[model samples]
Structures are given as structure tokens and as C-alpha cells.
Target: MSMYNEKVIQAFMSPKNVGAMENPDGVGEVGNPRCGDVMKIYLRVRDDRIEDIRFETFGCAAAIATSSTATEMVKGRTIEEALKLTNRDVAEALGGLPPEKIHCSLLAEEGIRAAIEDYRRRRQGLPPLPPRHDAVCHHEIPETGEETRE
Candidate 1:
């Protein structure tokens, strides 16, 4: 827990834009079974720019902090700029995360990508993509509750 820096702690303690948006232009949700973390990102786009962004994250402190930072990074930027955001960028903005918790930053990046993809698809009159569940560093349990390794 001490692995978190002051930036991480501050963001976690006072997360920004942490909520759902009504009638959002795009929405993305991603979950990691390994850490039991779930993140949802909503976007309001106007004139090809992200006019507003919000996120809902259910995970550790790192997850929440990363979510907060990621939104701040891309807000008021073009969709293309938002897509440029990487997991490493999120981690660096937070000063850094513990080795085990670095996946949280990845989740934040994925969430942003998902949301942008959704926005683009909608603009093209395409269908929304299925929710994404990317298990990072954890194997999925089968119906029998067993982890099978080939």
C-alpha cells in the first residue's frame, strides 16, 4: 500500500468526474477478473473533441486514482489525442504504481480506448461492441471453479 505515491493517494482520496453521464455519446466498460476490478467510462463529444468525461471504477485505490488521472488527461482533447493515452502515461502521471498494481493503469488506458471506439462506431452508425473483460495476471475459473493450464 505504501507503494503508492502522493499523487496516487491524492487522486484516490479525491477522485474527479467519478460518475455516470446521462445520454453520453459513448460508453465503455471493462473488467479484470484477476483483480476483480471494473471500470466504466462515459464520454460527451462535441465537434470531435471530448467535451466531458467521467468514470466509475470499482477496485483498489490504484484503480480509482488511475481512473481519475486518465479522464483529466484527455478531457477537452480530440478523440485522436485521447487515443494516444497509454497505460505508461497513466502510471507516470500518478508518479507510478506498485508492480502488482500496475495493471490498474492498463485498465484505465483500455477504458479510454473502449469509449473512443464506441464513439467512433456510433458516429459511423455501427453497433456498440460487447463489454470487454480482460483478465490481467489472473487465470479465469471455469464453471467447475478450476484453473486449467495447458
Candidate 2:
């Protein structure tokens, strides 16, 4: 069998911030059963910054590793800064994810952006971003378990 990268394996085996929050300021979930990956991200924001982040994921090793590393990356980051984080950053932080599983990292990044947008909407007294327009829709999952486009 091919060997997996040490850091990727480590992060997957011992994920950081791997639990849900008691009362998260924002929560976002994304899944694609066609690919058999699902993730739920939780956040606690303070002064327009992410004070804490956590996640619960059901997927392969790459998905778990990406989510864990992403939670750490977002902590203490302003909403705008966190939104700037991309799947490439998450994969790079994990020493790179396999090409076939790259979507796992993308999912983690999407989850973070979704959570932050939700926080922003709530703070500004606006409704959540519509699923179709948000790029990372979380309001409604399609029957296939993937996000539906408008």
C-alpha cells in the first residue's frame, strides 16, 4: 500500500478542536453523500473575530484532517481574514491532501465561510444568506446529499 504523509496521518489520527461547542455563535454543516463526506463546523465569535472553532466530521482521513487544521487556523482571526482562507491553505497546512480527496479540504473551507457568513448576517440583523447564492449553501441539502444549485 502507498504510504500516507506523516502530517496528514497525524492530524487525522489526533484531530484538534474536534468537538461541537456548547453554545456556538454560528454553526454550518455540509455534506455530499455522492462522495460520502459530511462536516459540521461550530464557531464562537468575539469582537468580530473567531475566538474559537470546532468541528465534527464524518468522512475519510483527509476530511477529518482538513477540518481539524482549519479550526486551528481560524481561531483569533477576524471574519474577513477567516473568509480569505481557502482549501489550498488547509491542504498546505496539512502538508497537502491527495488530489482525489481534495474536495474534503474544500468542504472544510466552505464550512468555515458558511459559519462566518452566518455570524455576519446575525450581527447585522440580516437573514442568513440564501442557499442558492451563498456559494456554500447549508440551509437545504438535496436528496442526493449534495448542495442544490438554483
Candidate 3:
């Protein structure tokens, strides 16, 4: 049987917010070297809320689905609210992902956080933060059913 659920397939096949934004308020790119999956997220924030969000992912179906769903999940949310979005939430929104593929959801979560941080930094006239490689390596494996640390 296919490991992916209907929701996952639907999202993967018809990913929302799949393109880059022009003059985005913030941008974040993350990758998993282990699997060679890369994802980039763009954000446009207004009044402390995410007015628009988009993503481009070069990865497996799970990665694409998570990226697409993550954009839907964060749009119209306050930056603080977006920060609270979790990998589990992304997975849950897609019904679920295979244990081994759960990391894709983490990528989505980190991408959104990184993008929001970038926006905050730019708004404050600060330089962009360094690229993040820790999102995958340091993150607790979400498939273990462990609660991730912020």
C-alpha cells in the first residue's frame, strides 16, 4: 500500500503557494543534506500578520505537501502564531506522514520560522541571519512522538 494518505497526495499533487514571491518581506531556504531535499519559503507580512506566503521545494512528495500545507497554515496568522506552528501540526494537517519522512514537516516548520525571523530582522534594519543547517540535525525526530523543544 502507498504510505501516503489521501490528504498528502492531494497536497503534493496540487501544492498551493508553490512559486516565489517578488520582493518578499522575508525569505528562508533550508535543506536536508542527508536526503538532498531543499525548500525555500517567501513571506509578505503586514500589520504583524503573514499576509502572503509561498514555497518552492525540490524534494519528495512529503516535502512538497508539507511546504504547500505550511503556507496555507501560516497565511493570515500573526508572526507569533506562525512561530507556534509545529511539525506535528503540519503532519497532522496532511493526515500524517511516514515515520521516515516526518523530517519533511520539520523542514516546513523551520522554513516558516526562519522566514519570519528574516522579516523581523529586515523590518528592524538588521542584516539577515546566517543560513540554518541545524533545523534537521538538531531537531528532535518528530516521528518518535516526542514533543519538540522551541
Candidate 4:
């Protein structure tokens, strides 16, 4: 049986917001050396909400799909709301991913958080975070302290 669901396939096949944004309010990048997957998220903020969002993911189908869906989920959301978006939420929105591929969702969550962090830093005149090789799956619980994978 195929591991990917219909929603996953659809998202992967025709991902939305799957490109770089010019003059973005913030940008964040992450990568995984083991799998050689890289992801960069861009944000355009208005007031306290995410006016727009985009992503560039170089990875598997799951990775692309998650990135696409994650951006859609947070496109018009407030920073606080977007910060609360979880990997599980992304997975669930896509009707769930395979056990082994759930990490892709984590990567999406990480990408979102990273981009927002950069935005906050820029707003505060602080330096952006150094590039970190912590993209796909660190397999650690998020700040919400809730387990994401099923």
C-alpha cells in the first residue's frame, strides 16, 4: 500500500507558496546532514499577523507537502497563533503521514518557528540566528511539551 495519503500527494504535486519571497520581513533556514534535506522559510508580516508566507524545501515528498501545508495554515495568522502551530497539526491537516515520515512535519514546524524568530529579532534590531543543522527530525518534543507524532 502507498504510504502517502491523497492530501499528501495533492499537496506534494501542486504545492502552494513554494518559492522564495523578495524583501521578506524575515528568513530562516535549516538542513539535515544525514538526509541532505534543506528548508528555508520566508515571512512577510503586517502588524502582528503573518501577511504572507513562503517556503523553499529541498527534500522528499513529505517534506515539500508539509512545508506547503504549513505555510497555508499560517498565512494570515497572528504571530502568537502561528507560534502555536504544531507538527501534529500539519500532519493532521494533510490527513496524517507515515510513521517514518512524520519527521517531515517536524521540519515544517521548525521552519515556521525559525522564520518567526528571525522576524522578531529583526523587529528588535537583534541579529538573526546562526544557521543550524537541525532541520528534519531532531526527534525532540516542541516547546508546547506535547508529543506530536501519533
Cα lDDT of model 2 by residue, 1-150, tens digit:
224588889998999998879977887777654556778888899888899999988788878988999989989999889999987788788776555566777788888988877777777888764432234423222234232111
Pairs in steric clash, model 1: none
Go through the candidates in order and give each one's C-alpha lDDT: 0.84, 0.76, 0.84, 0.85
In candidate 4, position 123 carries an lDDT of 93
Q: Candidate 3 — which residues are off by over 4 angstroms?
A: 133-143, 146-150
Instruction: State in Å the error of residue 79, model 2.
Output: 1.0
TM-score of each: 0.87, 0.80, 0.87, 0.87
Residue 116, model 2: Cα distance from true site in angstroms:
0.7
Q: How good is model 4 by TM-score?
A: 0.87
Question: For model 4, what is the C-alpha lDDT against the true structure?
Answer: 0.85
Error of 4 at 96 (Å): 0.8
Give the local distance difference test score of model 3: 0.84
RMSD of each: 7.2, 7.7, 3.9, 3.7
How far residue 97's Cα lies from its native spot in candidate 4, in Å, is 0.3
lDDT of 3 by residue, 17-100 (tens): 989899999999887656667788999989999999999898889889999999999999999999999988998888777776
Worst 10 residues of 3 by lDDT: 141-150
Write the residue-wise lDDT of candidate 4 on 20-102 in tens digits: 89999988787675775678999999998999999999888988999999999999999999999998899999987776676
Clashing pairs in 2: none
Question: Model 1, 28-131: lDDT tens per residue?
Answer: 99986555798999999999999999999989898899999999999999999999999778888887676667667878998999999998899999998677
Q: In model 2, where is the ten-residue run with the lowest total lDDT?
A: 141-150
Tell me how far candidate 3 lies from the true structure as C-alpha RMSD in angstroms.
3.9
